[model samples]
Target: MIAYLIGNIKDKYEDFVILETNGIGYEIFIPFPFDENYIKIYIFEHIKEDCYDLYGFLTFKDKEIFKKLISINGVGPRTACQMIKTYGIDQLINYIILEDTKSLSQIIGIGPKISKRIVLELKDIFLKKYSQNIYSTYKYDAVLALMALGYSKLDSQNSVNNIFLPNDTTEDIIKKALQILAQKV
Candidate 1:
């Protein structure tokens, strides 16, 4: 198994990113937190029925958490990514600690039944490695904007909270959330 890859970013696509190390380009699954600091990443490869998928995480803890997430009965990589995208690792940790299955289900692709299962199975694993410092600094102003525009807090939270990779700042979050929210009106 490949442990990790440290390289320069050769190119980035919409879903996958190409990292060049020693003249080889490794395309890894693009996590939302892949930014300037994540050009070099540790990867976990999962062999499936028809394909091998490489999931990337900037930290070993994150990779471990990802592994635990996918280990849930029905939680797949996509759902795990969706979970991280929506509430991030801290909120996920918080939710797990609080047993907030409702919040977990709010993540795209994670239903209540599956979320309850996740809370039951993986909560202990994630809380042990959860980092509050990183996610505490994480702030999203977009949700506030959506709330200001008369959208429900949960809706706004879910909308701006579910942005894809290429992690944006509070300002960027607001801009993109507005663009997405505009589609509704």
Candidate 2:
């Protein structure tokens, strides 16, 4: 398993990115757009009988969550990518924990039955994993604060990542995030 990739992006398409490392260009499917020309990202390498694919995520947790999503009987990599792209990890976890089928069903290929299945199957796992993590709350709050300030979730996340400090309060995080977001515009 190729667990990580550190490289300069050769190209970015609608659903995938080509990262060049050591004369090799690896195409990695991504759930959201990333701006940096150079990236160091966690990777999930999926191999099947017919194809080999690599999926990248900015955070290790997101990659782990993606693996879990693909472990479900009916969910595949494409569906999992769509899920992350549509709802993001925080919102997806929130919907699952809250059993918000209506919201979950909004993703393409996810109907009421699949939504309920996802919620029922993954709620315990997500809550058990994330409930006690203080960072999760901070991430959720920062995302909401950024969204309230008119930044999309993808932009907010890119801005807020790697900026959190242990001593920083939620307000401090939001302020720092806003500053970073402003610079990108």
Candidate 2 Cα lDDT to native: 0.86
Task: Show pairs that collide, candidate 1.
Answer: none
- Residue lDDT tens for model 2, 65-132: 89888887678999999999988888777777767899988888888888888888888998788754
Candidate 1 at residue 60, lDDT?
82
Identify the leading candidate in terms of TM-score: 2
TM-score of 2: 0.72
Q: What is the C-alpha RMSD, rounded to one decimal, of candidate 1? A: 10.8
Task: Give one digit per residue, the lDDT tens place, for model 1 in 143-176.
Answer: 6666887878876776666763344556676677
Candidate 2 minimal-lDDT segment of 10 residues:
131-140
RMSD of each: 10.8, 8.7
